[model samples]
Target: MLLQSHLRSVNPDATTIENAAFVAYRKDATNPDHFIPVVPSESIAEAPYILHLLPALPPAWPNGHIEGLRARGGCEVDVTWRNGALASANVRAPHGGSLRLYADGSLSKTIRLGAGETIAWPLP
Candidate 1:
């Protein structure tokens, strides 16, 4: 993925930071994946980061399950599983967050913290 940013224009007062573009691409020919091109009418697209959390057991879960968490900016994700497994991660900007898979698929709870605030989501 390639990202580019530039200053489009500056007013007399120089109070506004106008027009930014984010270009995503895959250079490898083996993995040819293309994103929906953004036109002048619609310049900006908001792509949210998603993490999949799944059980680590054999046979029952192969690719694991999708975790319904949309992360933005800098945040931390804390995961707790039923099999006494605990994991925590801090996410940085410029690159999307990381996806942490717990051994025990049965997650008890997940906590997301950002900017001195925390949101807790319980799983079934």
Candidate 2:
């Protein structure tokens, strides 16, 4: 399964994502030691899965930036960014499923996806 790299951008361009399968990042974008890529264990069968990579571990910080991520499925999500910082996301899944949203500071949320439904998720 491959995910589009442009999903990482606050303002995605027309460039298409190709030949990539993993979305990678660091808990702290500035900390090279914490870099990790998010790889889904199973092929996405329901919602189009996309990730919003926050700028910092707490994510509530006033500053941060975007990181690259990759995944599969055919759901389009609109990510909301505030002043170059991560804020929230609107997600939709075509077949319905579940996702565990995670943050660097042990913060996580389990979202239930309904078929052809859109869900909005806010970040801390």
Residue-level lDDT tens digits of model 2 in 1-124: 1122223221122122221213454365778667666654454233223243442445354543332232234455555466544466555667765543322222234456689877655533
Models, CA RMSD each: 14.2, 12.6
lDDT of 1 by residue, 20-43 (tens): 122333355555564454333232
> Could you tell me which residue pairs clash in candidate 1?
55-105
The lDDT per prediction is 0.29, 0.42
- TM-score of every candidate relative to the true structure: 0.27, 0.40
Segments of candidate 1 deviating more than 4 angstroms: 1-45, 54-72, 84-114
Q: How well does candidate 2 score on lDDT at residue 62? A: 52
